[model samples]
Target: FSAGNNENSIEAHIGINGEANLDFLNIPLTIPEMTLPYTTLTTPQVKDFSLWEKTGLKDFLKTTKQSFDLSVKAQYKKNKDEHIIPIPFYAKDFQVLSTPNDIFIPAMGNITYDFSFKSVLITLNTNVGLYNQSDIVAYFLTSSSSVTDALQYKLEGTSSLTRKRGLKLATALSLSNKFMEGNHDSTFSLTKKNMEASVTTSAEVQIPILRMKFKQELNGNTKSKPTVSSSIELMYDLNSTATGTINHKLNLESLTSYFYIESSTKGDIKGSVLSLEYSGTIDSEASTYLNSKSTRSSVKLQGASKVD
Candidate 1:
């Protein structure tokens, strides 16, 4: 059991992130296949709006027009098993509680959340972001960490200089890190009422692997509507060759389909093949309509060894 409060304490920033009041209790778990024999930690936490008025979060939620979320967060983590490859099953998280938000205290419009995806120094509250910080913590649980450290106030501004009639022309700068740490393997998107499609370009530098990737994604504003959409990605590394991919999905009342393809070559011009793969799926279980096949899947491979 654990208890935290700033009322009668010397420090006002009592819990991590200077949260005036915070408390939680962690239950332990044991596993034999792991190194520690004690395998995991289960923590149930609760947050209320007692001392939040002293925080930028008070302004953040107010400006974004979002009510404070008092949801119960049960945190879980499994330590890395020395007997197995080092994959510490913990929650990979970084939150800038105060630093960046101080940049633009008086935000004009749009939701400017505490920046989480970019470069910043991590503070004591488990928020890890120091300029050029390369150490990667294994966090398998993706909801996120409880507290934050630094902050960067991203201007809630939009540029429509390139916008043309009937077509959307815009660009955005959001903060996001690698995928294995957060949302991947599945996709969940939200589109505003007046928004139609989005074209986004992103560049990522993976420090641990010394790898970098540049990608572009296009998404249509067809959530409850039936339409065809596509996303294309391009990537390059210093020691490796360039690669490109084309992925598309279609959702309609009577039909649904998806297609994806990616390839890499040894050299710029005619060169040895490196790897190529593409897969497609068609189904109706999730959609209102039914499919000729409950599920269909396929893949094509090239210039790679296949094992039985």
Candidate 2:
């Protein structure tokens, strides 16, 4: 006898090879459940031998986990669209031969890297000119064309002698010593409706001194390097003198007078941080002397301030 089950029912049959068979047509089967103790799943006092820890499998897993994260990031970056930025180009003495548009960077994945011309063989010449008035006039051998042209136009239409004299004096000065530093030229006209003659002189002096001094200031803790502070002080002095004669043509005799001005600047430095203090004083005197008749005036001014 043999037993089998199908969709309809379970069956039992008896048969022999190459012989007539008779069969039990219908039978039913039942499956019964078995019970186990919960203690079987509880942790045992004796632990299982760990091949994973002994073979460093945990470290391997950790490393591979990081690799998985990197692989995911790489895939995400690869699937994204490329970004492009325009490069501003400048040229003075060289020319570009070739430019590349795209390259692969590990940090940024596939990025559009623009590498341009780096090396080329070329010869170049540049000109930079520095000139003083003495040199420029010596080169041209005459007044500048612009000044000459303007003077010619003004000379044709002007009738005032003082104006003509002023223009001539300006041309002479420009041709001779316009840019001559610390040069004093004395020439004046006393024949106009309002006649004035003056000599002006100015001088500037600057003295800069750098000083280094050790200052012990605690930054925060005791074991760090001490900060070093540098102090700079600048002293400046300016002197201006004007000697002149004024003729007011209106019942006042020509007066000869002189004016003197002096100014002194001083600076003070303090603190580890950058700081500056400045003080200045100005002294001025005006005096007119003619034939033992003299008038005098004087003024003094001072100021100070600090900056941080």
Candidate 3:
């Protein structure tokens, strides 16, 4: 993500200056160094990924806006006695001579086209841009039953700002309305230089789901990755209809590995887990012998019944 504002490399600086800047809400944004994730995305960075993850629909659609990205996806399923197949070729921003959506294998089968657009955004970081800016984003989905109608639509919006409000805070407020599920979600995040706190509230019915996270980092030696950290998270899930909390700790060493552990302070299945991940340099001989990179990584995870 923009290389975390490094200053030592001449090439990095040259790369940054040789970029074409775009605008999102007139924020002097740029195309991502990588491919754009989708077309409808707005940049900087709201931490709304978890909200989408909880909805279990994040992985269904993917899009890219650069460098001729393409994907062929197929799904298999069983229905009654007939087997059906649907293959879709996704291409970005290309004016097609013919519609790719209609080129199915078994003509006029049960398979139908589902045309959807992915939400993607890329941005540039400026001292006086993007911060404190708010916007409302809406999506329109077409009906499969009829091409002219709408099956469902969803709207999500966010406003974020970072300032030295006595303690250097980056605050973000986000809200989402998913009419397809009759759900309205609100999330708030406040992060200092070394600490972050977030709360999310969503309701599908009378009992609203609430989640919270609070974290603090010690010895801030990195920008994107923290060296030492501690956190507590509380969650109430609609499925379990119960509440749970976890306390977590992390210790990371650059260019090598990291260790982490967590304990559930409360949950339907109260438990804890400890894990360690190590990467880089497993032996020069192994790297040469295996014809692989000079790096190797390993992970271990174990569960514990208690927190105290």
**Highest TM-score scorer:** 1
Ranking by TM-score: 1, 3, 2
**CA RMSD per model (angstroms):** 24.8, 41.5, 28.8
lDDT of 1 by residue, 1-308 (tens): 23233422211121122222222111223334324346575444434434335444444333323222221222222222223233323334744333222122321111111222211222211221111112222212112332352231222222332222333334333444332111122122334444455455555665543454555554545555544444444343433332332333333332244322222222111112356433222222222333554544444333332222
lDDT of 1: 0.32
Candidate 1: misplaced stretches above 4 Å? 1-171, 174-195, 199-201, 206-208, 221-225, 232-303, 306-308
Structure candidate 2, residue pairs in collision = none
**Model 3 misplacement above 4 A:** 1-171, 176-232, 237-243, 253-308
Any runs in candidate 2 off by more than 4 Å, and if so which?
1-170, 173-298, 305-308
Per-model TM-score versus the true fold: 0.24, 0.17, 0.20
| TM-score of predicted structure 1 | 0.24
lDDT of 2 at 45: 43
Model 2, 1-308: lDDT tens digits are: 55554443333434322221112111223334334476445433433434435444444343222111000000111222334654545454575533545543322222111111111111111112212221121111112212222221110010112334332121121122222212233334443333333333322222233222211111111122212122222322221111111111101223224222222223332332233333323323233324444444444444343443
Error of 2 at 181 (Å): 11
- Per-candidate clash tally: 13, 0, 2
